[model samples]
Target: MKFIHAADLHLDSPFLGLTGLPSSLLATVRQSTFTAATKVFDQALAQQVDFVLLAGDLFDRAEQSVAAQAYLFQQFDRLDQAQIPVIVSFGNHDYLADQHQTVAYPKNVTVLGSQVTTKTLTLADGETVAISGFSYPQRWVASDPLPDFPVHAATDWHIGMLHGAVATGSDDHYAPFTVDELLSKRYDYWALGHIHHRQTLNQQPPILYAGNTQGRAINETGAKGAYLVTSDHGHLQPQFFSTATIEWATATLDAANLTTLTALGTRLTDWLASQPAAQPTLTALTVTHLQLDATDLTSLRQGEWLNLYLRTHARQLKAAHRYLVSVTPQVQPQALTAPQLDQQYWDQGAAAVFTPANLQATFGKLAQEPALADWFTQATQDATLRPQAEQVLAELMGKEDPDVS
Candidate 1:
């Protein structure tokens, strides 16, 4: 009873990292889906996995690109030929808004229809696996839907799949759920998604999120891949596999005492060399750096040459790793720590800024400002969310340059 469990294949995801991707990587925007889907298909074939579950997010948007659709079809074709069943359901990102139509997928594809229900897949050997799945009908479902799932049902093995959050603290407001509530279902395995970071929600019965196929943004950094689940003497766990064509990485070069760009270069060189070397055929890399101070050190190659400088070092990195460095300095730290970099002072400033009253007052005053009128109007309606917004705004304002040049 082995299956390849993957989710959040945000096909044709515009760009893998973030806005303003380099020109060289720009053309691959629409082709990201194809690249990632191709890898998944190849991996599935190599692993000879019996089933594949696309827990949700089959498209980046409701009206996904034709190129993306074609690419998906091609992958499904391969799966069909291999006789592996691919089970799919629409996630919030690819929900009803998803205008995907007019493309003929292989018979092996099981596009789960809307409305929460169970689909039973009986293998050729007469062993049965029931996938009790549900999908996001809209962009947001604020209510607790975990209670809606079938509990302790009769089945060989029940794999419950849904897309939401299961948390205990204030962060639970993000998606809202309780592990104890999920436990009521008593399913054999839970293949989940939505929160795009690989996590194990329940070790007792094994509830897991495979995370996004590839890191879609800078915040979605680090290793991105799928999971392979197998039962050993009726016990199971997941093995994380790296199938991402392009890897997104971030390294912060502390430009503190190292006042020279040459030092920064060598520092960056060491960091790049440190990245775990992956397979030979992988996509480019984006490296963002946060620097301090602005010293016109001659060792630092200026303009286009800087990238080339890093590229030269990147090439000398591990043999299997191929990457493009994306450099971003975090407001140049010396500037931030400077007396006026932010009206930002030292201990007192950081403390006063984080204080609740100061944050609320600052946010309330800023909310009254003319420039923020529209955003203010929209935010006022939700009383529960007001404090969060205020806290965030206060942080931003507190961090602003005390002297605006």
Candidate 2:
């Protein structure tokens, strides 16, 4: 009746967008995924949960990381020793493929296959639970897999494990299913995955995404962990637990009186000393309500200021157990209102320049590099790129006085 639900382990994956970190912090980043995952296993052993459900993306198969494979084998073996059953449904990142078919996990680990299947386990407390799910055969499912899922089984509890997304009507590569479709099956619980933000779609039957085990990037900020679900008064309840050794956070600093890089560094150091986190935090700092000359703004924009601050303020950062991942200027749209240029013109310019084609054209040869291309693609899809574009335009406008006549 009790189990731990987790997803998107992303084991042995390198932390993205990190540069010039301290040697000790860099080592922590390398082991963060494994360390976070160990907390989940540790919880399982301590709580003596009947089973564990890993919804999906346990690891990126494309990376071919030996450390990830070995870590899973070792952990699964540990779970087996504790007589805890682990049900895993691999998502797109670690889809079922021929290359890793030969390797076997421990006896307690049951990796669901490509076809929709149900695995039933009888708990020591005499409760029978049926878990139904499927692994991604390849990178994309591209279809409604609801029809393939069977009806609720004749057991004490029925849980559906899905590594997919909500139906977006078009261009959905992952297995897409609506909440209605999930509720139609009348399962006791839905352990969802793929989306890296934890959310609950329904409360009664406990439909949820456990999010990623650790925060890997600035966008994946805040507490990162899994859920421990237990049956309570005929209803299943999920409680979150933090597993991340290092946390990612974004904070806005008021730069009303700040005019120079030295002042910015002092303010940042003071801010770090004021705030604290239980775990080492990697912070993305944004300056607001500030006016800077082109040269100073360019330093921040080009990361020259941030790099210099990191080097000079290493002692402060180390004392706070924090790292400044980025320092950005929040340029308000109202600040860009020029005497000659109208808001309409700015909007028109944005419309013309911010298109995907334009971005791709501007990206040019850099797109040829796979890593940069992937980053560009994800950045374009998210809202991160628009503000950057706006900041660039604001800088250009700040430098030149345009004539309407």
Candidate 3:
């Protein structure tokens, strides 16, 4: 009893936040989702799993992408050739809709409907298994779907598939359920979706999320992939495998020895040369322990220096198989601490000022302006606002007094 559990394919994802990249890297980024999906199917073929479970959000139906549709049909047929069964439960992004069913998937594919239903399968080894799940009827399902699920069936294994988050008490638009509720069902395993970070809610009977197959943004950094679960001695063992062709990462470089923009560029180039990536990596680098002057720091902040560095060091970037998506200074908080105010006091004041309520109150009537309002809203929501403000103040102090350190 072996199967691959995967979710949040997002096949037509635009890989947002990536701009001003070289044509070659941009092309790779564009194809990264498809490439990552191909690896999953390839793994299925290689492992010869009895079945595959796609928890949800296979593709964004709103996009109406012909390529994504064609790709799914082609890949499903490939699995059909191997006589592998695929169970799909569409999430909010690709909910149950009449238009989408205009063309059906291959015979081996089983797409659950909007209502909870159980599908029973008899493995080649004569073991019976029951799989229960449902697809989202619309963009949001505020109600809890746990009550609709039946207790463990009279089969060798009972797996419950759900595509929603846990009960958060409020603002939970997705089909929310609690761990206790899922445990009450006594299912052998619970395959989850919607949340894009792979994690396990429970070890016994294994309540898990297979996460997205590809990293679509910088925030979704690290290895993105699916899990291969194999039935052990009365328990299921799951293993994660990387499927993403390109990865997003954040790194830091010490600027203790560098003083000029030229020195910084040379050092960055040398650092890239020192470390070559196994795959195309998009890196957000931060310069720490900064000693740069105000003008150079301003250039770095404005992205002018980075743009020039990327353009001139194109060969080095390509050779290293890494792209510097962003470069910024990480000003030490201690540098901004005044003699009159201790570090703890400064921290407390910054925390108090950065609160959502405080920031919103500070914005006041200016928030009425459309464009400025949007930026203000985002700024207030940003977690690093306080740190970024401190960095700005530190830069200003440095500009005012070059020998401040």
Number of the top lDDT candidate: 2
Displacement of the residue 3 alpha carbon in candidate 2, Å: 1.0
Query: Among all windows of ten consecutive residues in candidate 1, which has the lowest summed lDDT?
Result: 370-379
Ranked by TM-score, the better of candidates 1 and 2 is: 2
Candidate 1 lDDT, 1-405, residue by residue in tens: 778788888886765333333445445544655566567778888888778888887777667788778878888998999999998877767765454577878999877665667878887666688887776666555667676678756657788787767654432322357777777888888888776789998885888999988766555666778888876576566788876656655545555555555676676666656654564223333223434334432223233435555456645554435344444343322322334444535545556555546645666866443223223333233454544555545546666887775
Instruction: List candidate 1 segments past 4 Å from native.
Output: 16-33, 167-175, 254-257, 260-263, 266-405
Ranking by TM-score: 2, 3, 1
TM-score of 3: 0.82
Tell how far residue 90 is off in model 1, in angstroms: 1.4
CA lDDT of each candidate?
0.65, 0.85, 0.84
Ranking by lDDT: 2, 3, 1
| Number of clashes found in candidate 2 | 0
| C-alpha RMSD between model 2 and the true structure | 3.6
TM-score of each: 0.70, 0.88, 0.82
RMSD per candidate (Å) reads: 7.8, 3.6, 5.6
Clashing pairs in 2: none
Q: Which residues of candidate 2, in runs, are more than 4 Å off?
A: 98-102, 334-387, 390-405
